[model samples]
Target: MNLNKYPVTELSGNGKLVYGCDYNPEQWSREVWQEDVQLMKQAGVNLVAINIFGWAELESSPGNYSFERLDEILDLLHEHGIGVNLGTGTSSTPAWLTTLHPEILPQSADGVRAWPGGRQAWCSSSPVYREHALRLVEQVSRRYGAHPAVRLWHVSNELGCHNALCYCDVSASAFRGWLRNRYETLDALNAAWGTTFWSQRYSGWDQVLPPRTTISAYNPTQVLDFHRFSSDELLGYYSAEAEILRQHSTVPVTTNFMITAHIRTQDYWSWAPHMDVIANDHYLDHRLEAPTIELAFAADATRGLAQGSPWLLMEHSTSAVNWQPRNIAKAPGEMIRNSLAHLARGADGLCFFQWRASVQGSEKFHSAMLPHAGTDSRVWKEVVELGGILERLTEVGGSTVTAEAALVFSWEAWWAYDRESHPSSDIAYLDQVHAAYKALWEAGITVDIVAPGADLSAYKLAVVPGLYLVRDSDAAALADYVAGGGHALVTFFSGIVDENEKVRTGGYPGAYRELLGIRTEEFLPLAPGDTPPLDNGTAASLWSEALRLEGAEAMVSFTGGHLAGTAAVTRNRHGAGTAWYLGTALEPAALRETLTQAAAGAGITVASTPEGLETVVRSNGDRSYVFLINHSHEEHKHAIQGQELVVGEEVADVVVVPAGAVRVVRTSTPAHPTNGLPTGSKDVESD
Candidate 1:
């Protein structure tokens, strides 16, 4: 039987809880430090992310370093019995370096040189920047690598922040290198980029430059190349620091990834294999649908990276987050509910953004373990209660579970879409992907968020929507998956470009033309609310492409705006399996039907649950735990089965705890197996 090292575990259906919070003693006095630890212990907080923004304090000058304060803080935390995810403190460059070598500073896309006021403001392509940053990380890793309390190595904090697309001399040089590696000859490069039409063909390697205003010409090909180059450049920074940490540390290495921002830079699929446990900082606007469903996608993305290994919920808000438009306090039980949501989604550890309230600066108003109102506040009580629950469920502490189906998501595709310069600028790639994910969630199917090249044998089907970029071997892999009896579902704007961000010339959906069995000859951009009548007599808009089936059968056809009776959806059968293609961005109703039909062809089963009930199942060996979270404001009844594990009585019209309340129901008999994960499923409840 296949076994997992850390399987999902549940304490009688109340999910497993891992407690930790971001601890920044640098912002607080020593007197306050003592109180923070005491409160953390009371909350059952066990993991601490320390020294996230300490490079300025650690290395004050060239060849001079100070660790007296950090040493004391580490010792104090160790004495308090908390595990540490140690930060290398190289995220923010020292002011001295930026002052001496101004080239180390990043330039914006509009070619404006960035002022080094915020963290992660250094240029990725700057040699001086990389050299010093590497030195600092090496020094920090060497000194703290042996700490007994250190559980994981946290690389430079959230490496991708705002204004990530830098276009400087260093970036220009790197872009040329990237192009040379991707396309060996100028002729090949020109042909792939279709530069002959615009007189953009390069005569020599020296003529190549980063896609900037001066030499870029601002064409679709140029913008796409620039996006690819910037992504690789940022990845290089991550690679350098990861290598440094690996040299001195045996623990897994990770950098904090944030939710809903900087979607282009940090490609976790590329970096996940290097991480011991992927950690994320989740702070969403409360007005948005409770982020529990989004959190499940994040967890699956993390698990997919480590092949079903659980990750850490590194930084969540204990109370309120300061970054939102309106910094609203998490309502009664919302904090605890959100934490449980993370666990329900497969988090092995739960940590907040701050342990204590920041006394000053940008995050001063942000909530923490101890709110500004002090220890006796409601927030503090909730934190303590949450900790007590975690303390009680120590048995399922380091568990993980497996996913049977996954949706393929890629950052390269995201970046490429941003640079595509399509006829419609309003077509949002992230929103499209989330729409697909939301449909799958609404259908009660357990969907694992995956990156390109993730193993498809374990999953019966894989769905990739809005895949604008296809690199080397990616097409081959998808073809292989289909040829091997695994079904694939892909949507609009796919197979248009190669790894070089150049359009594939033979036909539209170029590389995947044969696999998809369709040739997109005409680009038909439909305006919003404009109806493109389909063969089924149904109309749709939001961008439509007139496509003809080459060896495939049309499922839906456009019938308006000069493309009537043109194929909008088609399917190709290949080696006992099928490839479904969506040519137009359908509305939610049609998209769900299309997704459901595609899934049925693959034999993927949807859970028997009510609509809007966010469901996720993580299995180990013979047991599986399904989390049914009713995220909507109104109460609803959810019909759930698959070996009930929760201890409480099963109610038919189960009152799925409203907006902030959660229920933990057992779904299976816990039978520990040899060589399997410690717990099959644990700590599953809605926040």
Candidate 2:
């Protein structure tokens, strides 16, 4: 977890926070560009991302390049003292190149070619696409690597957004090569993939294929490896382009990672070290029951990628997003609340997808800094107000977010646990993690979403929920953390499989059965819509395990479920700390209470504040910035003595925060207090 504290220092030039958006000069006329920059000055925007999807304009035809338009755009932006986060312009394939060579197109598992009408239509493993994309990348990096306006080199627009897995012949060959490197021989590969199960053993490496659309349910390990291969393939593409950019530039390189819930293509934990500055694109997912909770979880996970260092909020929306089934417009002042929430959780820079709304295209209806209604819009006013807020947060650029608890997050587990065959598909990895995180968030506990193998010594409490697939070493790390005076909460359906998705044969939850002092005989997965009652007056849900406690005490037991008297939750004393096991999914409210108790038992100071008023802190050496966001409709008052940065007022005691508003209190108090910490203080750093 060793990381540089804000490696991209240039982003905040002369101690000004970054407030900008993706600028598509290619989308507008020359006259409009001047107005846009002038408006940018008025809006306090200091940076703009350009050329993200500029492939068609950068290279109009094969062997014929034109940079005259881009040269003018960069010169104009620099004249206005606006820096650029330059993109390589290879995200979308040029129609000319794809038309000339259709082999570069990505194919579906059922042998369907995704055409060039959409962005990211190229296959990741195609040498032909790599040649053209790299050629374009080489040109862009060489031209702008030393350009004064270029502050960061964006490799591509969301590297694995669309073309993560292409089940084409080229992808098949690439997957075989990747497996060869991983397993080294056919025998090891067969053993790892467990090909002995369905008479699917492969004699030669040539027999291997991308787990293509199979008849029924495919081998789990094969699917898992292909998921690994697909992510690595896209990562390999990013690495190739980044290597070229590094040869030409000293500027920090990164791409906007899709850390939101919907996109799970790339494993960002593996991709984090490669980024000089961790940047993520997160949008409010309205489809969920609670998008706000998911937003907090996503930001925490992104910070974890940086190992709790400050990260960049690369992209978010100012209003309604066009992509969702129901594009819900943000209420007035809601945008401000969202941006402040990200800042409260470690984002140094706040940027959006585009500067202006599109007049035509698939994303025309998507929200932007300047929407279709132009300067008179509510979104435009909010964007200006947000820019002002960021300008006041100059001291928070490199300061880290505070966390006392840690949640183990894994992409491998996410890939494997959501496969076709599983007990209770209703219970998902995201659901369980979100449930735990929401609980912690409700308890006023800021948590770090860490990788399974990361050192957990810094946290007082560690939560491992629904991590179905974990490496043996990582499972041991959890046990070690618990044994070394760290409280652990391991939930149902976890520790059931190894890295290869192989079951631990002796009993369920093979990895941590000994440490938990429990042995499960069989799984008791409840049918959908069944919420059986627990003896503790709460309810057990989605899953349960028929188990016998060897050396643990039953904290809760089932009363109405199939296993009436079985232990639903157990607590065991390992060494210097305690290990808690949840055999069944508890109801959401009950889950929060249990998690809050675990947090309290670990000696974490659970806040007594009301649920809707979210409090988080960021600190430098001696100064602390307290951020308060009122999610509820009622106005709230907090006892804090400091100068409010947003409203530019001094508070003697109580700070009044209006409904649907955000407040940042600037004080000289140390955010991370070692001893005699005040009640309701969640400012202590995880380090």
Best by lDDT: 2
TM-score of each model, in listed order: 0.86, 0.97
For model 1, the stretches where C-alpha displacement exceeds 4 angstroms are 1-17, 178-197, 214-222, 259-262, 285-292, 327-329, 392-402, 533-538, 557-564, 634-659, 669-687
- The worst-scoring run of ten residues by lDDT in candidate 2 lies at 678-687
RMSD of each: 5.1, 2.6
lDDT, candidates in the order shown: 0.70, 0.86
Question: Which run of 10 residues does model 1 get worst, by summed lDDT?
Answer: 674-683
- What does candidate 2's lDDT look like per residue over 483-587, in tens digits? 899999998888999998889989878899987989999987888877888988988778887899989899999888468888999999988889999998887
